[model samples]
Target chain A: MHIPDGFLNIPVSAGAAALSIGAVSLAVKKVQKTIEDRLVPLMGVLAAFIFAAQMFNFPVAGGTSGHLLGGMLAVVVVGPWAAMIVLTCVLIVQCLLFQDGGLLALGANVLNMAVIGVLCGWVAKKATNFLSRTAAIFIGSWISVVAAAAAAAAEMAISDTAPFATVLVAMVSVHAIIGTGEGVITILVVSFLKRVKPEIVEDGACRAL
Target chain B: MKNRKFIVFSLLACAAVVVFAAVFASSYPDGLEQVASKMGFENKMSGINLMGAPMPDYGLALFGAGPFSTLVAGLSGLAAVFLATTASGWAIKRLRRSGNG
Candidate 1:
């Protein structure tokens, strides 16, 4: 979910902004140092796909809808550093072009969806390394959305915009459903990639599928 | 899908979604908005009208709220995102290379 402006207090916003900036700079460095030349277009593809995918929000449950967050998918394809940059690009484009999100809250969105979401989801996927490629990516994508929502709820609570317990439960529970949508789309896209470009998909075979 | 074919196929997929979003994207509130509305914090939004943005909410002011408007707007966004990502990646790579030399 794209957090609007005024959802975060000045301190929380500023702190998140600082962290996002620092992390993005580090991402640039890490990506540049280790990024394969072939991966550049792939990054562009991911960023564009995310930006477009976010536009198509599908209904989830109880009058709520969700879209693919794409962070986990990015990580699965391009690794965290490049995925971070890719996500930051999509978030910024949404902010400045689509106004789907707010400028003041850009930092929090990046921090939540790009940094925390990707990294934590990466951990979860790595933890489930024993699983098939399909399963791991789906689980990871699901976790990314939940983790991002949790971070957003935490920021709102810290800003006193919403009650901690109620908002946290609401955000987490609803996002847990939304996470399923994220997982499904990530699987669909990754599976498509695996079929078309086997080299790019790393483990093109899924043990279960 | 690598290089030209990859970029081309990706853009086509993005364009297809752009049309899908313009035509039939869900209008329901997302989880955050649903929660905020339920919890009485929905009005906490600053409602900043970004006058500078070319497309707001993925619709063009010129074409108004119809599907065609959304179509043009979504296409514009797709092009913008693709260009921006590629340009930024190239620029960052150049910057990193310059630091080494």
Candidate 2:
């Protein structure tokens, strides 16, 4: 769901860019009152983990492989605001280093994948926690990925990159499955971290999980 | 663990993980690329001419993966995390200090 360069028109991209920046700023403000110094490095480490995890592409149905976007993983491991910063770092590195995404389209990519993905993923996790872990992770990840994809597809549609319905279907349907991978990976990683460093969660340093 | 020292250790540990990730990453086309290939847009994929970028294709434009590629991508990811997190932390700190929290 990383919208490469030239996928969206300049105006639509710029609009989404502004929204992303605004959301990040708001996230920082929201977390500042509660953020402790100890959480900073935790967030950074989680970001790096996300960066690495994103490199491993899992095979989806139809022989296509999709990697963990880590928006949910980061949020689950850290808080949402810090996750934003963390995932932003991952996105920037992936784009500049791997040529996997575009430099000019960084704003749109972050908005869709980092901002929308983390926020929606966190909400979905919270909503589904009443169910089993498997169900929670599966549904949470599915919703987040589909939401991000839908947002990206909307941007593309508004930008006239592809027909609205085509982009929506292509992105949402595929990402629906991709979200399952995301959910499982997120739950496993968070569970591992919780076992190793329970204090991070016990102390309220990690909230999104 | 003290806060400052823990942070340093976490950073180093993340750097190590990045190396592992780059090395162990599957060498296959990702979801988008696969979809594009199947959907007939694969031919439209074009290389960007970004000047002097490091570690293109996770391998500095080299053909195959190796320790060098892994190390480079790992280090780059580490640097990015450091820069972004530090900047964000400082910003948060500054905002708090300004009584704007």
Q: Best candidate, TM-score-wise?
A: 1
User: Which 10 consecutive residues of model 2 chain A have the lowest summed lDDT?
Assistant: A200-209
lDDT tens digits, residue span B1-101, model 2: 55566567666766766666666655556655554555554454446735444776666545356867666766776677566766667778678888999
The per-model DockQ list reads 0.73, 0.45
Model 1 reproduced share of reference interface contacts: 0.80
Q: How big is the positional error of residue A85 in model 1, measured in Å on the Cα after superposition?
A: 0.2
Instruction: List, residue by residue over A1-209, the lDDT tens digit for candidate 1.
Output: 99988789989989999999999988888777765556777778888889889888899879888888998888877888788999999888888987877888999999999999999888888888688777888888889999999999999999999889989999999999999899999989888987887666674211111
Question: How much lDDT does candidate 2 score?
Answer: 0.71
Q: Which stretches of candidate 1 lie over 4 Å from their true place?
A: A203-209
Residue B75, model 2: lDDT of 76
**Model 2 reproduced share of reference interface contacts:** 0.41
Q: What's the C-alpha lDDT at position A133 in model 1?
A: 71
Q: What is the per-residue lDDT of model 2 for residues A105-201, given as tens digits with 9 covering 90 to 100?
A: 7788889888998888778878877886557666767787888888877886787656778767887888888888887877776676666665664
